[model samples]
Target: MSFSASSPVSFVRAAVDGEIARFLDRRRAQLLEVGSELVPVADALEAMLAGGKRLRPAFCYWGWRGAGGADVAGIHAAAASLEFLQACALIHDDVIDNSDTRRGLPATHKRLESLHAASGWTGSAEAFGRGAAILIGDLCLAWSEDLYQASGLGPEALQTGRVPFDAMRTEVMAGQYLDMLEQVREDGGVEATLRVMHYKAAKYTVQRPLHLGAALAGRYDDLAPVYTDYGLPLGVAFQLRDDILGVFGDPEQTGKPAGDDLREGKRTLIVAETLERTGSADRAEFLRHLGDPLLSAETVEWMRGAAEDCGALAACERRIDDYVAQATAALETGRIDATARSALADLVVAATARKH
Candidate 1:
């Protein structure tokens, strides 16, 4: 379960994976105690957890390190808890977006649906799959809290970290709701899109993780601002890169079809900017294919071209570069240690410039 990276927090990343593996093993055994029918629930969760760069845990580790916290099993378990939370978000998000695949495999809901069909179940397979996936997400959410409680940290330390832990959960849900609203309202302005991105991903993915780490170290009051200064812009840049990859990234690398975001009717910054830049007639043409589920490769290419001609893609790239710069500047605040500073610098590239 370990992931090897050149970053300074690679050791922490491996430790977090070890923690997650051991925790899941316990969970799997408990599930089996109920019945063999529950094995697929464990399997789906493990499969979904198999991918990802483990970015969040790394940030949390560095946050702790920056705040002068020692490396320990408790922190690793605490960081591992974030992975369960992430799993909850991803599973439910796939259901909402009707994503067929994740990480080159059938999404949780689709997997359950296929199982229901193969078993010749009597009920609606689609509904069964969706319902099962939703329950799995709920289970993951509950398990996140369970893992946190089992982290073995003292009451004081756990209490400190709980602030950001709780805030991250609440903010992510709020952000997700805003994202849902954006999709429903077809709101894609810079302001609306950024507002959604900020709460949904920016704070949840980066800021709060860092805050969690610092909080556990009992240095939240001292380091909270620095974490935010670095985390917020970096998170936005990371998601902006994700938006670009959603549109133009290689399928082999991203594990998603090219232009999948467009097909899903995502009101991403790219789409919003493109709409703002195009003439009314061009906007109409672009909107026609923006969310076409059966969208053709030819049309995707045209939209790509249109986006390029309108400079929306280039504009996003520029913003990514600028935001990365802002995040980098925040690191020079003379608050973080040398090791944490250097590792966080490496993360800027990992977060904002990743392929998947």
Candidate 2:
């Protein structure tokens, strides 16, 4: 049956919940045997797994459904694997961004810091937290692989999906490095920034997920181009929406302080366009303050205005619209089960329309 936006997201949630529960249950013996200290780590990991939109898993499920698979068992297991992979990514991403929160709670590292401080036996709480979070991320990565292996995909399907998953991890790391390098380099221009966006956010987030889903469904050769045509533009738009929220979203809703991206000095497309459009003096002032972690609200407001005034916001909106249109066109051309295609169409709309 086709799912609608109005359809309860509960069905998807239920599937994911089962998968995660099974994952944790299978690891319970190992986790318990580790020691008392590891309990908190497990708690932190569980917290990170709570309350995500499950977008990637939805993509995987629908991709399989689209290929005419009615194997509920197989689809549910694969979806859970996607969620686990996403968990791994988010844990590491929080470490890389030095973010303090996730889903309205302390981030993994920050939570570890709190635990370290509460224990009253820390030399360097910050270092301890970072090191602990790294290990936790590594554990999640390993568990994600285990879940994928246990998902019951045949050897052929497993081999096919592994390629994109491997590429997705490798490319995201490279893209992240490119982003960090852009922040430090003297000559990070518009082109360089866009390249980073495509690699870091676009390809890994959307393209690879779609490809992985299709590959698992035994439609890799036929569905590859469709993924490229649809996933790339939509992923870029998704990240651009994220950039907008990073600067302008409500903290209560987005689970982060407003203008967090500015504080981090993210050289996003909006920022890049603002720099490109501004005069030399204004550009220099922006450059000087872009990466200041202690930037005031007033300064953030000023940067927001500059972005809007320079047509950066408008340009981004135009690009988002163009990409959405391209994705729609790609969907039109692809042959998939009618019900599954409709569900995916709904997903595309809802994903692009999200405010946080």
Candidate that scores best on lDDT = 1
- Report the C-alpha lDDT of model 1 over 1-356, residue by residue, as the tens digit: 22223465566778888988898999999999999999889999998877667888889988998898888889889989999999999999999999999988999999999999999999899999999999999999999999999999889999988899999999999999999999989855978999999999899989999999999999999999999999999999989999999999999999999999999989999999999998899899999888889999999998888888999999999999999999999999788877788888888888887788
TM-score of each: 0.97, 0.94
* lDDT, model 2, position 57: 72
Can you write out model 2's per-residue Cα lDDT over 24-77, one digit (the tens) per residue? 866865888987667888788788776687777777777676666674676677
Quote the RMSD, in angstroms, for model 1.
2.2
Q: What is the model-wide C-alpha lDDT for candidate 1?
A: 0.91
After superposition, the stretches of candidate 1 with alpha carbons farther than 4 Å from their true spots are 1-6
- CA lDDT, every prediction? 0.91, 0.80
lDDT of 1 at 44: 94
Off by over 4 Å in 2: 1-3, 6-11
Worst 10 residues of 2 by lDDT: 2-11
Q: What TM-score does structure 1 among the candidates reach?
A: 0.97
In candidate 2, the residue pairs with backbone N, CA or C atoms under 3 Å apart (3 or more residues apart, or in different chains) clash, namely: none
